[model samples]
Target: MKSLSLIVLLSMVFSCNTSAQKKDDQLQNKTAFKVTKTDAEWKAQLTDDQYQVLRKAATERPFSSPLNNNHSKGTYVCAACKTPLYKSEHKFDSGTGWPSFDRVIEGNVAFSTDTTIGYMRNEEHCATCGGHLGHVFDDGPRATTGKRHCINGDALEFVPAKS
Candidate 1:
């Protein structure tokens, strides 16, 4: 009888977790972004690295992106759709390997909850193309927005500000 009760409790816990996960997945997929592309179109347009990170939500190796060391005056645009996502002035070094920004360009980025790693994280993506940029965190420069927009450099293309 005790064994049966244990099994029942385990089943109930698992079912509740599965249902919650399903709801979260549905919420993530319900948004209609401004730009939509077929998978083949995206594959053809983006390099394998870009496709993996932007379309498949894969993370690039830490400190691997040249953009991490870039200190230029330009707008960081979405690699897939050229949507201006972050401004140079807003960029900062968070020592997190990825390009960290204090804030996103208003109206150009979107946010959703990510639970892929068994925990909740604030995921940011391009509002235009729905490309996954990276996760955001609350621990950032207190002087600024106090939010860290940790971005995948592979998902961005820097456009230098004109002289």
Candidate 2:
């Protein structure tokens, strides 16, 4: 009887995990963004690094992006859709090797819960194209929004502000 109970408990746990995975997959696949393109089109338009980070949710190497050290007045836009996402004034040095921002351009960015790392994190994405930009955390400047938008530089394109 003890062995049978253990088997039933294991089965229940597995089933619950399977269902949670299915839900997560559905969230990823079912969203309809303002801009949608075929995989081939995305491949042709973006470099390998851009495609991987934006479309496949892959992270670029730390300190590898030129934008991480950039401190110019500009707006950061989505690389895939060119939608304005972050303003230069909100950008900050989070020391995490990625382009960090304290806030996003409202309505241009979106958030979703991410559990791929075996823990829940708030993931950010471009609202226009549903491209994975990066993740957000509560640890940020207290003087500001107190939110760290740790964005992937490869997912962004800087547009200099007009003089």
In candidate 2, what are the lDDT values of residues 22-60, reduced to their tens digit?
A: 645544773557788889999999999999999999999
What shift in Å separates residue 139 of candidate 1 from its native position after superposition?
0.7
Worst 10-residue lDDT window, candidate 1: 22-31
The lDDT for every candidate, in the order shown, is 0.90, 0.90
Model 2 TM-score (2 dp): 0.85
Candidate 1: which pairs clash?
A: none
Over 1-163, each residue of candidate 1 has an lDDT whose tens digit, in order, gives: 9999999999998777565566446435634777787889999999999999999999999999999999999999999999999999999999999999999999998777898899999998888878899999999999989999999999999999999
For candidate 2, the lDDT comes to 0.90
Off by over 4 Å in 1: 1-31
The superposed Cα distance between candidate 1 and the true structure at residue 98, in angstroms, equals 0.5
Using TM-score, give the best candidate's number.
2
